[model samples]
Target: MTHTPQKPIGSGFGPASTADEVIRGISLTGKTVVVTGGASGIGIETVRAFRSAGARVIVPARDTAKAKAALATMPDVIVEVMDLPEPTAIDRFASRVLSLTDKLDVLVNNAGVMAEPLTRDARGYEMQFAANHLGHFQLTCRLWPALVRAEGARVVALSSYGHRRAGIDFRDPHFERREYDRWVAYGRAKTANALFAVALDSIGRQWNVRAFAVHPGGIATPLACHMLPSEIEASQIFDAEGKPVIDPENNKKTPEQGAATSVWCATSPQLAGMGGVYCADCDIAIALPSDGSAEMHGVRPHAIDPISAGRLWQLSEQLTDATLD
Candidate 1:
């Protein structure tokens, strides 16, 4: 696939566009949305904003009881037990969802595990890569039919700045013989998320289904809980005032702020004819410098490279034997 270097298309929204702001005039009354990790943090907030906009949000969570309790006060929000760490669970959950809904307007791959001690999923894939990328990859394929049935469906893969640190290591993704650094694993997974969107868009565009990868910016959310206090201190994410340090000039978005990009990508008319782009601050991101360094302006070349995306897709199919066309 050939990718064009991205340029903002005058979205009329910026870094501060809240979720509510993005869907201001839209009504999702009969639309169905699936949000992973919708029981907490930006994910839950995303659920709330979508539900309020009239979408019946389905939250697939690891803990059914916990998700039910957390969403007890929210109407039109249903909880289903699904654990991404277990591929079988995801398969089961997707089957159940398909039985209930014929069309899906939005699918948000928002659940993720950050830097943690090395671990593996039930299938023996590295935990960070499995939960963060492959699980979502499989789920999207399982849900493809429903997405194609909808008039216009969108898939949002939540990527992050951490992608800057690493690219997918197709040669040794399972970390079978190599020492593992948690951050590097997380980076690989996040990079996979971006690549997934690239390939998904290539295949789904004909069905009026577009895929977008998003960087929600720096938000103080549970997604960062794996880091120690010392790491947080060194991150300079907080200000002397103890509030989340926001550098307006540099453009850091809060959770509500961060969510804007996903919501925007999912709904904004500005993207009516668009697909397969890395988005931040509620707009398509500028392309990274072709040199491929961490300190670049846009997505890493490897992340959206067609050859890499296709390679990962084929590996993923072999890993799970999930061949969805």
Candidate 2:
């Protein structure tokens, strides 16, 4: 398969576009969608948009009560329990989804943990990497049959510009050797998110199940609860009065706006033949230069490199004991 270029294709939507706008006029009446983090932040907005378009949405959350409360207004949206960092929970959740429907039209790996103090999963893998990458990796493989059944499905992995912090450290992804830097761990996990898309798209295209990685811009959400006030202030995503700034042009966006690109990637007709590209602002992100210039935006070579993607896939399968068949 020819690689899709990491350049915008004039999607006619800009950074300011909302999920409602990107999905306008599209109907997903009989479709089924599974958004991992569908109960909070941009995830909720994404679920709202899909529901508005008439899709049957399922949200698998680690905290079912919180998820149910957050989604209470949308009574039709299904809520199940699954923790990304837990392999047994992921398998159980996948089984439930398959039992509910034979096909899955869209799968958004939107749930993730950002920079946090060193923590590990049951297998001793770094928490951020475990939940953000390996967890999704296992879940996707478990749902492979459902995806193929759809015949024209899409998987959107929520990556971030944070990936620019560091590439995958193959030798010690779990921080077993190197000193643990929260930002570096977060970056490596985010990079894994992007690379997962790159590899999944390459493999799934044969089954007409394409995948894309999304950078939802910066939005003030519960996802940032782990961030310190000083860090948040330094990031400049908030105003003097402590209000979350809304500046889509500069990547600071509202939750609805942040959900736009994920919605577009999953349902847009404009991207019908596209896959395996990093997207932001409702369009394919341009590739960044290798010289560290223009680092704040665009897809970096390490994130989209096919070779790295393949290697990550192999590593993920080995770590999770799951494989896409």
The TM-scores of all predictions, comma-separated, are 0.95, 0.99
TM-score of 1: 0.95
Question: TM-score of predicted model 2?
Answer: 0.99
> Whole-model Cα lDDT per candidate?
0.85, 0.95
Model 1 lDDT, residue 289, Cα: 66
* Local accuracy of candidate 2 as per-residue lDDT tens digits, 1-325: 5778899999999999999999999999999999989999999999999999999999999889999999999999999999999999999999999999999999999999999899999999999999999999999999999999999999999999999989998988899999999999999999999999999999999999999999999999988888988999899999999899998999999999999999999999999878999999999999988826566889888999999999999999999999987
Count of backbone collisions in candidate 1: 0
Clashes of 2: 0
Q: Write the per-residue lDDT of candidate 1 for residues 1-325, one digit (tens) a residue.
A: 2443466777888877788898888888999999998888788778888888899889999889888888888955888889887878989999989988999999999999999888887778899999999889889989989999996899999998788878888889989988999999999998999988988888888888999999888787787889988888887778877688775335555778877888888878878868888888888887776525646346777777888888988888888777665
Model 2 residue 325 CA deviation (Å) reads: 2.1
What CA RMSD would candidate 2 show? Answer: 0.8
